[model samples]
Target: MNYIKNMEQEKALFLANEVTVQAGQIVSKTLAQNPHVSITLFAFGKGEEISSHDSSGDAMVLVLEGTGQFTVDGSEYVLGVGESLIMPAKKPHAVFAKEAFKMLLTVVFPSAT
Candidate 1:
């Protein structure tokens, strides 16, 4: 039985080591990969920003829904909606929403071919 129901009419949305961004209407989704672990998704609108980054592996951030501010290495975290944070690899992270936000990010990879 092969059954896949509607991921926007599903035709290749399996993003391995993924990153998606849309500004103007504001949309952002980022996933790393898995079968070991790596996943990311972020959506923002009202003052969206995701700048400053550094990671070769080991990352986690989950705040699915409105309000956000997460910055590691410089230390700043003010999040809402089920908040979460864990970051270590290259160590430099950033995110800001502050009104419209949706996020779920997980990345864990060191060595596995």
Candidate 2:
């Protein structure tokens, strides 16, 4: 199933169908990519995390399942299903999964703003 909600608009599919979280592993899928923006899906297993990093583009994470703890610019935010947060361009950020989780990530490059 194609889980990219906004991409491949010629057809329709649910976000839950795109990718799945697994034991001790992280999964991801790229729905679209361009100079202006990129759409991707990520599934993180419990206790998994992505190291802190800075992005040239503004990145938004939309939680689709379970829970995630986000550190953006030195502040921590805990999000559950349906929650979303934007990490601004050039800011330090990291993501940690307290539980198995899934999310849609949209990054908008500087040129697009």
Candidate 3:
């Protein structure tokens, strides 16, 4: 993602109902981005998952529909629609769709300078 350094910032409004969930697939849409943070919307089909990984920046997941199982550093947490969780920086994390689910992910990074 590139910074719109010299131009006026761009804004986009998204309706959660418009994000579609496909069978046996995971889809994502990046809504906003900048040097410091990124906001992404994701739809995961039943039994779909993201394998274990760690990020340098802190990340947050807000469940918009259905349920998800998040294993953060070996601790399991089940989050449903309207629930949220914060995964700390440098921690091992994995995501699994309890069924079909949708989430809004926000990752915040420290200043590069």
Candidate No. with top lDDT? 2
Q: Candidate 3's residue-wise lDDT over 1-113, tens digit each?
A: 45432223564644456478998999888867777887888899999999999987899999999999999999999999889999998999999988999998999988897
lDDT of 2 by residue, 25-93 (tens): 889888878788889999999999999999999999999989999999899999999999999999999
For residues 26-79, what per-residue lDDT tens digits would candidate 1 score against the true structure?
Answer: 554433354467665666677778788998887877776667888899999888
Candidate with top TM-score is 2
Q: For candidate 1, what is the TM-score?
A: 0.31
For lDDT, candidate 1 versus 2, the one ahead is 2
> What lDDT is obtained when candidate 1 is compared to the true structure?
0.68
Measured by TM-score, how close is model 3 to the native structure? Answer: 0.85
Residue 80 lDDT, candidate 1, scale 0-100:
83
Ranking by TM-score: 2, 3, 1
Q: Tally clashes: model 3.
A: 0
> Given candidate 3, what's the lDDT at residue 102?
93
Error at 80, model 1, angstroms: 15
Each model's lDDT: 0.68, 0.90, 0.86
**Root-mean-square deviation of every model:** 10.4, 3.5, 4.1
